[model samples]
Target: MQETYRRSADSAKGRQRRAELLESVTRDLAEHGLVDFSLRRAARAAGTTHKVLLYYFADGDDLLAQALLRLRGQRVGNALQAVAALPSGTLGDRIRAIWPMLEADATGLRVIDQAIGLAMYDPARYAHLAREAAEQYLAPLTGLLPPEWSSARREEVANLLLATFRGFLMDWRTTSDTTRIESALEALARAMDREAADGP
Candidate 1:
């Protein structure tokens, strides 16, 4: 009985430590992107030892995968809230309100873009994360559409909207032109509204 109780207590502590470490890694990724992320640095950031970090995350790649998942969850939550608060108006209004939120966190967006590139080379690592991101981040936008639309049509439109945002980010990253990015998003918003109304 004592052994069992001790094991239970240890499990709880382990879970709590893992959570804290994951949170620290997430903040670092959001602030610094993933390119320069180091497991030793993350351990220091979490106020723990490298051994402890390794115990929780087998390696840097594992740590990165978990960080990406957590970041994806956060972005999804923000997107959902943004959509919920959108006033009743044309799709442009909704898009405009959300565009700034996405633009404000350029580091996070760039990390995701980098993840996409990494996934191309590592299909196994990329496939699960990609599915999670699409289901969590993309599905919410799809939910904003009318229910009358077919599943295939809804997915197509959602992909287009997501692609437009990503494309705008790529341009903004290179050019740093807020006006051009805003103009492109505005045009895409109008196109989305037209497609949503036209059916499929």
Candidate 2:
């Protein structure tokens, strides 16, 4: 009985420690970009040794995957909360509603963009992370669509909206041209609103 209790306590402690470490790494990545991340760097950010990080995470990639996913979740969670606070509006309103939140989080967007760039740079290492991030963002947007639409249509629109938003985000980040980005977003919102209304 004592041995079992001891093991259970150890497992609980391990989980808590891992969560703390993950939070530290997430904050670090937010402050410092993920362009040249390494296990040692994460360990340094967490104020622990690389060996300790390995004990909790499989490797640098696994740690990065979790951190990126956490960042994405925070972004989605914030957007959902913002949307919930507003009155139900057109599809265009929803698109417009979410943009300011995304636009405000320069750090979060930078991390996401960096993750995508990393995945593209080395597909073998980071491709799964990028795919998972896409799915995470896609599901919530699909849920926001009208129920009358077919599943296929909702998914298709979700993909196009995400792609468009990502492109505009990159452009905005690179150019810092709010006027051009806002114009593009307005065009997108109009297009989406039309598609949603003219549906099967």
Candidate 3:
């Protein structure tokens, strides 16, 4: 009985440690970017041993992938929920309403930027994560669009939207230009509205 109890306690502790490690990794990637992040550094930042980090994550790539997934899921879920709550209106209104929420998730955006940079050299890893992000994050946004739009058009718009967002975020990180970001989004909203007015 005592052995079983000890085993259960150990399992709980392991779970807690893994969660802490993930949180630390998320913050580190957000703050420092992930160009040269090392697992040993993450372990030390988390106040844990390198072996412990390995126990939870296979390697730095695996840890980064999982961290990106977790951050994407949470932030995208919130953004989609906000978008859903917006009243039925022109696409511009919908897009504008959700911009603030997207802007607030700066950390999530940084994690995504890091993931994309890493994915360039590692197609297999990129494909795996791209699939997950598409299903969980991109699909929801596309689903919110008008049904008359074709699949190809929807895909194009989704890609453009994500690219625009990432570009603006990268600029914002360097320039801290909230006004420019807002103005750019405003232009996008107007353009999207014009496109909708023209109809399919």
Candidate 4:
């Protein structure tokens, strides 16, 4: 479900500048999130003008898509590192160890929360973001699975866990019911542990 955005510019210098701008934009998105996101603000942070941004991007949406991809990459990369540092154990145990790290990333969660809301209230504008994020965000976790796991099984577990995690976030977002969500996540962890024990 990943979406494509602006490609590398033809000139080497242009491509380098585009990449640099994209890095700044990604940082802006991480720090400020999607709420009231502005091209001008991103341009200011990147030490460029909005017109230059448009020169690189078709429009703000195009810029946003590319920025989201970068953010997703960083978030997934961080998760991979955190997961790696955990004491080796069953896949579920590793997952459990990393769950807190995932949750602790409030900036990442904030970005996804915006996408989740957009997916519901304004799908025309945001559905792709959510869908793409679900795919991109879960990819690293899938890669962490045992070598015996086929690509098919890896994708299956990744999508399941990603959707389940998002569902928990949605519930929390809507109702602020941490107790119930925690209970549900606990049940899910147990189920995952059992499944990992049984193996594919």
Top candidate on TM-score is 2
Tens-place lDDT digits, model 3, residues 1-200: 65564465369786787788898887777777776778888887788888767777777878877778777776777777887787677888877876676667556466675565556668765666656665666676687677798888888887777767667766876688999888999999898888777776
lDDT of 4 by residue, 27-110 (tens): 888888888888898899899999889878888888988988886676666677887887677676666665555555566546
Sorted by lDDT (best first), the order is 2, 4, 3, 1
Colliding residue pairs in candidate 4:
none
- The TM-score obtained by model 3 is 0.71
- Model 4 whole-model lDDT (C-alpha atoms): 0.76
Using Cα atoms with residue i matched to residue i, what is each candidate's TM-score against the true structure? 0.80, 0.90, 0.71, 0.82
Residue 112 accuracy (lDDT) in model 3 = 71
Cα lDDT of model 2 by residue, 1-200, tens digit: 65564465359787889899999999999888886788989999999999878777878889988998888888888788878878778888888888887777766557877787778898998799779988999998998788999999989989998888888877877899999999988998898889877976
Candidate 1: 10-residue stretch with minimal lDDT: 1-10
Question: Which parts of model 2 have CA positions greater than 4 angstroms off?
Answer: 1-10, 106-109
Model 1: per-residue lDDT, tens digit, 1-200? 65564465359787787888889888887777766678888887788887777777767778887888888766667766787787676665667666776666755656766676566678876666556556666777787667888988878878877778777767877789999788888788888688767864
Clashes of each: 0, 0, 0, 0
> Scored by CA lDDT, what does every candidate get?
0.74, 0.85, 0.74, 0.76
Q: lDDT score, residue 16, model 2? A: 89
